[model samples]
Target: MPRSQPAIPICPPFPISGILRAARRRSDLSQRELARAAKVSAATVGRSESGTILPSINTFATLLAAAGFFLAVVDPDGNVLQPMKTRDDLRDGAERLYPAHLDVIPDPEPGEWWADIYGLARPPETFYRDRRRRDYQRRLSQWQVRVSKHRHLPEPRLHHYRDAP
Candidate 1:
């Protein structure tokens, strides 16, 4: 007899969008209708369904309320899921982090592109530094908004240059 491969997990860690979609379907609610009930835009529902964006904590709470489901999330196996908020999880779960460097470089001059390619004009180092700072601030703001609605959870601590040598 041949050995069988192990079964893979069918559900995702969060699967917030899937949960919302299921609830909406069970209620015969259109995305626009659900969004209206949740006091959010239809685009929000569409994005959530597509897994393109994770709703903020407040938004999630509102959605669950509208769907008549408790705010708690559960795994497919009926296990209650704990919050998985962490730097790495956020990095992976979010659409994208604010770009660390916002300096947009144009294509090099037509004929001179290959000449001293390494010496091409680059944005000032300070430009990158400023962009990094701004990105950090933007992330912090989002974190703050999330934590505000989840008052029971400890706030995330922001550390600058955490991995810099």
Candidate 2:
């Protein structure tokens, strides 16, 4: 018998321009029509469909909505990714579980990118549950001392030394 190889999952390519054009065409809408319905300039729609410019998610969603289409985050096999809003999905066969307070969407700090999404909401960068808090503090303090001393003489000379003119 011949040996069979396991199938590897292939990632689906997201061709923005092609998708936009196809969706628009499917609705029989021209760039101008799509733009008008989306409340954007015709040039923007044309550029997006032609691949000359990349449209923001907001604008793209607007256009898709106008064309009776929708923008959805999907995985390789077209499975919708994270489709449920944390606030709305409370025990609707969800795979992830969290306490009520922690279940809702969290507000990210200013200049911070999607804090909760990146796990930044849990703790500071230096914190890890496996490491003892005291040990981490000691190491951090030592690091600070080394960093501060680094700007000073790399090596101190106890022997007599003179600066040359």
Candidate 3:
């Protein structure tokens, strides 16, 4: 029997159409002019604004840039979130990215590595930690610091809201 493909989740429509229209107005650019600047078809700009089509992330960002604006990711407090740094220098024997769940150690001492038992010489500066040992150390630190009892709490209520019935 042929295997069935998993259903891809469809995202609900966003207010990107309105945002693009507003940005175009602010930049004083017609749809055709914006399209020319963004190197897209005028129909594409029109359809995007009319909600007939949803632009891909790259296309949306390009259109916004043409309208003298840029897209950004921000928190509820309006703080811009920075993207995670890429560590191109770090990799394993197969050159695949280190497992994100585990901590990676660099230049470990001899006999500390599992592959050392086989007497295989590893590439320079490549090292790994035992997952169980790392987890044990993390748990021990949490217990010593009593992290469970003092876990993060929500912000306090405002003074005005405190008196509200």
Candidate 4:
């Protein structure tokens, strides 16, 4: 058998200091001029270019804007990723933001949800358990119907849950 080589992990470029310096030079802006434009101190701009301290996202964006540049996030294939819009209206009973991974369904039908068995009126919007649980329950119910019609028990289908980031 031939020996296999280990896969090398790919790292994205992150030369922020170099990028800032280049952008400032390209825009013909001195450190003090850039600082004044960005509403930050000249020392802060110098320290950022020298990599003495890393700026926050907002600060970095501001600095870039002052140097006539803008920051953007792109995928490996160079596709720009837009930020998700904030949903101010949707909220749980405790007014906490729902997990982004879960799907939010609006106005579920009666007895269509597991929580409906409590006899309380359904909320206007809600999120259920992961899809695996719902799929398993649906398949199990169908299997039960088949078993009743054939007068014999059969192995039921199974589902697996996928964890979300």
Clashing pairs for predicted structure model 2, backbone only: none
Cα shift from native, residue 62, model 3 (Å): 0.7
Per lDDT, the best of the predicted structures is 4
The regions of model 1 sitting more than 4 angstroms off are 1-12, 73-165
Ranking by TM-score: 4, 3, 2, 1
RMSD of each: 15.8, 20.5, 11.9, 11.6
**TM-score for each candidate, following the candidate numbering:** 0.38, 0.45, 0.58, 0.66
Model 2 vs truth, CA RMSD = 20.5
What would the per-residue lDDT of candidate 2 be over residues 1-165, giving only the tens digit for each residue? 343567877767668889888889899998888889999999999998888999899988888899999877776778987754453333323544444322222332443333445554332211122223334445555556887755453433222223311
The lDDT per prediction is 0.64, 0.63, 0.78, 0.80
TM-score, cand. 1? 0.38
Tell me the tens digit of each residue's lDDT in model 3 across 103-162: 566776787667888998855554445544565555555655875663564323322323
* CA shift of 124, model 2, Å: 23
lDDT of 3: 0.78
Which candidate comes out best when scored by TM-score? Answer: 4
Off by over 4 Å in 3: 1-13, 100-103, 109-165
The better-scoring model by TM-score among 1 and 3 is 3
Q: Looking at model 4, how many pairs of residues clash?
A: 0
Q: Give the candidates in order of lDDT, highest first.
A: 4, 3, 1, 2
Between the candidate structures 2 and 4, which one is better when assessed by TM-score?
4
